[model samples]
Target: MANYYIVGLSTIIGLTILSLLYDSFDMDMYNCGSTLRNLVVTAPHDTTREFSSKNVTFDIAGKQWKDVIVLVHIQKTGGSNFGRHLKANLMLEKPCVCQRGSKVCNCSRLGSEKEQWLFSEHSVGWACGLHADWTEMINCVPSMLDKFENARQKRRYFYVTMLREPFARFLSEWQHVKRGATWFSSLHMCDGHVPTKKELPLCYKDASWAGVSLDEFLSCPFNLATNRQTRMLADLTKVGCYSSLSDAETKVKMLESAKENLRRFAFFGLTENQVDTQLLFEDTFKLKFMEDFIQRNDTNAASIKQEDLTVEQIQRIYDVNAEDFLLYDYARDLFKERVSAMRARRKRRIPS
Candidate 1:
């Protein structure tokens, strides 16, 4: 009896010591696992853990390869270049087939040429109308893909986009308009209906607002160029499409809606932070770009020197794009936080 009691006591102590060691060693590992799970399960919601720790070395059957990537191309946000990159730059097992001097590319999924993995202008050719906004794309993409494939199958969609500094983007759009560019083909579909002329008045009576002065451009109250990013990102129904609302109310609701939608996106990049954008994208999707993204400081918008503008002119620009400015500020901060977290995770994984 005495020997048995001693043996039992020794067993209990050993078990307790093992539990303590495990608790000490596994606490960090457990936290990391949780973070990774949250990242995958509830991404864009949890900003703290933005990358997975698991080895994401490419697999043809992996989610990254199987699922679709939808690009919401906001105008003048370097989206055209990024879209081109998506079609031709990724190190994929089966590269997109591009024809010389053609804007379209065949980005079919691996093992099935009939099915596509990318839905963008370069691949799908504005299937959801020209430069479809979030509301239209979300509602239209799934059905459009089904129609394109001529069959229905469940597939995950990871929406991505690029955002630029508000004032820069605004100026870029103004420059583009000045150069005779027009998106008159753009179907501003919202809530299953297009805005009527009464709701969305044209800024110009001519075919295009070409050679328009800055004063004329800003004078148009219904100019889509104003707060273009925010409107493109937000669900238009929230503010009754293009229906009239008090200026104060419109600003508040639109800005909040835009921010919320931005947070929900699978991934977004800033035009200014090309390097970090590439890194964040690679980390998020486990895909690599063949070449580094080059930053261009000599864009049309960048050419308009800040010193060249008057104080009131600058103030008007800000006032017109107030919502976009707020949205960009939020996006910039969130982007930084996500990049920092990814870097820290990568650094920890390296051998010391």
Candidate 2:
């Protein structure tokens, strides 16, 4: 009787130890999986090759509700129109509530009015600074959200943006500047410090670069508008911010970094490809827009005739925006590939 009792006690103890070990192993695997996912999603990759869509997966609706969508609004990328669409056009279970004469809308989560799901100028009002770049957004957005919520919680951030053809975007920016539009309020925060006057001088002495000629616009070596898209999308810190702006090697690194970072973004749209942009956005987030996106060719930049410029002047424009031209080409190709993959996936989902 005593031997039988001892055997039973030993068996129970052995089973309890095995269960605890199994639970610990399971938890470890879960933590490991989370870490791996983060690494795959966020880590910088080779800029030479295109990334496969198979590895890029997201919990669309769940993330849209639970996580934050950060928009890196590059100027003259048709981002303003897209922002408006996000605020008013999206068909959602909990639509963003906007107030009259307000620049911002309440893009709160499903149940929480205070906790926001979308972080952009339209939703959060330049919370990271006026037209914050990728470097500034990545650094400021997470902490800003924590401050807004008055709590610290780990939340995934999905960054999105829109890209435009380099020449058109540059022309649009010039037109905007010509109309007295100045992004002078932009902090240009990088590496925990704004670029000093010596590091980044103003293109004009006046309050705004109004009525500036295209030649004058191109003449300013410090003109942020020259390669605006590349600079905005790149991690400036990698190229030593504005300090190494003139270095050829630095420009190369910045362009490469920008390409890699753009690839890492959750989604990006092309201003020229409105239909594809809308379809991709809808498929990406599992959310629909109330109306189809309309392609507007009659933009400020479109008004500028290429035939009006000399061959030399055209070459100069392309030379100045060389980095942006490369970046845009890369982005457009990637965007098309993703759109094709999305269409293929949709076809597969339909019943035979």
Candidate 3:
């Protein structure tokens, strides 16, 4: 975030004009007292724990997982790179719904259409992997484990996901949509925040953020800018779409559940630590990704420099993604612990 900046040179009246132009800005409408403050909320009581204490690492001695891996692909979190690696190293079965000559792959079915195809009728007897729909498959273990044929295969169902710093991800997503990324065109086609007609899809209607500036967009009630990682990790059925207004107990339970689920994952990686992430994959799955493989997508969307965002935008982003920040911290600690444990185990291999 050191490189990130906000262009915070606007006057109070300037902000007013920007808000009026966007039609949804209300940062000035808040009823705070004279002395403005930025309060940092502490993580939940249960947010901290010894990562090494969790028994989440899988035993791959027989490499039963060599054929089956499930990835929960979080957008803009180096998913393209990860998918590229998978395509290059592993023999993927083409999706059932996606025809052989189709130029566009529709993954709109519960956001796991690709994963659905992986387990669909057409994908049997293939050594491949699936990009899971996190929302539809929040109970990561059982949802993926059930896909395996038997107990032996179930033991090999590897689940992995990568997380990013929330603000960076949100900024990337905004820029991606702003630039009209081909993949996100479904939701990015609309020209404004609200659709003029009644027929637009919910995503497009809600995310028609075209005319709004970054600060203006951040000020609005943007769903994707919220604790997205937490939402994806959360068992939404159990907790039911948490918000700042949700009861305290409910949010705590959701956070606790998400952390527990992360522990249950075969491997949890970070976009900031892509090398380590790939190393974990190679070490766990026993496959080498080629050095020359194009892992990242080419994008002209410039990153939002931290200094370029207003104080309000920065605070808004932080406040909105508070849950994700905590989750990312926990995941970082877990990743380090798991990597250290792997190295220690390697040192004690006792060559036969």
User: TM-score winner among the candidates?
Assistant: 2
**lDDT of every model, 2 decimals:** 0.76, 0.77, 0.48
- Write down the TM-score of every candidate: 0.83, 0.84, 0.59
Better of 1 and 3 by lDDT: 1
Instruction: For residues 1-352, write the lDDT of model 1, one tens digit per residue.
Output: 1122232344334433443443322223213555545554444222122234464232334355336788999999999999988899999989999899989988887777767888899998999999999888988888888898888756656678999988889889999999999899889998899889888888999999999988888888999888899889987788888785326566566666676667656679999999999998888878899999999989998899877877667667877776676578678887887788789978998999
Tens digit per residue, CA lDDT, model 2, 149-247 = 787756667778999988788888999999999999999999999999999999999889999998899899999998899899999998899997867
Q: In candidate 3, where is summed lDDT lowest over 10 consecutive residues?
A: 39-48
Can you write out model 3's per-residue Cα lDDT over 182-240, one digit (the tens) per residue? Answer: 23232211112222233322234444546546665565453454566775675555554
Question: How much is the lDDT of residue 262 in candidate 2?
Answer: 78
> What TM value does model 3 have?
0.59
| Candidate 2 lDDT | 0.77
Which predicted model would earn the best lDDT? 2
Of the two candidates 1 and 2, the one with more favorable lDDT, higher being better, is 2
